[model samples]
Target: MRRRFVIEAVMVATYGHLLVPSRPIDYVVPYSTILELYDMRDGSDPVMDNADDDAHVRGKISELIAFFEDPLNRKKIEKAMQMPWRESSPLLLSDEIQFTVVHAVDNASYGEFFDPIETELLLTGSKLNVPLLSDQFEFQDRLIEAEVPVQVYDIEDFEFAVEEGISTVDAGLRGE
Candidate 1:
């Protein structure tokens, strides 16, 4: 679960170069809790499934996915923030990336309404070890006079924000 959060963070950063914010950025995050009698089998339809199938099981999964998939939901997620992300020139320094993290908070929860699951993903310096590329680098005094700039940072350096969430229940207790 932690790994997924980290991956999502990096993905959001790297893809920011390709993403444009569509709304006023807010930072209040919404956490969800689903209460189900039991769990469901993967790929099994609860509507026509067996006795083990739970009625509210699929609803929870669908709701969870929808919250993170819809653009509207993403807007809502950003609404929980302190500052809004606007169009800026390509990032060139570690400080710029760090600025984003200061306002990034964990406001996600996944569990049953009563007995739900909860996880937290906090960002620290260790989480963002790499720096954003300031400028293309070249070997100035090489034997050959070839002049080419090389990409020096991971694509994740550019990710500015995220509008995603995740949820999971306990193990061995699936409804379907």
Candidate 2:
């Protein structure tokens, strides 16, 4: 089972770009309207933005959002993060791509609930060397040892991303 706790880090980050905050609706609030509802087009404040191009950002992010939000899909992704993904089925990164890691990340919010998720993914999936694209290099040594070839991954031709080897991860989250 996944554990939860208070995170002490001054700031936190999570991999992937489809996670959005769930806004519970209250019919009693007469002032609220569907127009006021948050949309994925309004992206979050980035820790760093390295993407120069924005063409595929919306499509890719939306595709992932749908995958993660489904109940059966989320469970599979959680299992992948917990165990070597090859032991289970691969996830659909897109309609044509069935990757080993994918899911809804609602409870996987930063600070407390999801602090260890990526760490656990690296730890558990070390043996499989799954094709991963992550911001955190928590287990760089293991990833390298497994011959998984850790190079910078970016769709845009941003010089900073290439120079700094930081892949641009854009996620849509509802900000307060």
Candidate 3:
């Protein structure tokens, strides 16, 4: 069965609709998802558990809505959208992926390394190579690459005017 994942990549945010027919809900992607992608490219399973979208992405969506709805952070958000690692989308997995988590290795007792996230773009069977923010982690300086693409989805893909803006109340997780 196909699994859902979040890949944090540097991508431009699109609204009102997507090119794909599957993505129907509003969601957000964090910066850590890319590490899983890197691991996947390196022939590692990264995670064996199902890690679909969750509260964190929703929280980010809420934050984005609140930030943009105010008409104050609009420009800043818009600019951030264009920059890499600023915006993200969910990735549709092809039976091989199953993950979504913050890039952390605080499990010193476990002795592990953590790092990237991506769910912003989707191009199944297609490979992707992105620059890493090496400074974020100690070992990242050595691992700076990503590959393969999955189904991509935008958080807000419904018709909404910039002036109209989406309110946290109106743009609820369920779009209720």
Candidate that scores best on TM-score: 2
- Looking at model 3, report the run of 10 residues with the lowest lDDT sum: 123-132
Task: Please tell me which predicted candidate would have the highest lDDT against the true structure.
Answer: 2
lDDT of 2 by residue, 9-43 (tens): 11111222212212211110000111111243345
Candidate 2 Cα outliers beyond 4 Å, as residue runs: 1-43, 47-59, 70-88, 93-96, 102-118, 127-176
Q: Model 3, range 1-176, lDDT digits (tens) per residue?
A: 22232334211111212223243322233433333333333443322243432333333344333433345333443444564444323232223322222222122221222221212222110122211111123232222233222222223422222123343245332221
TM-scores of all candidate predictions against the true structure: 0.20, 0.32, 0.20
Per-prediction tally of clashes? 23, 3, 25
lDDT of 3 at 4: 30
Ranking by lDDT: 2, 3, 1
Tens digit of lDDT per residue, candidate 1, span 5-76? 122222232243422433222221112211111232245544334443343435444544443445754454
* Candidate lDDT values, in order: 0.26, 0.30, 0.29
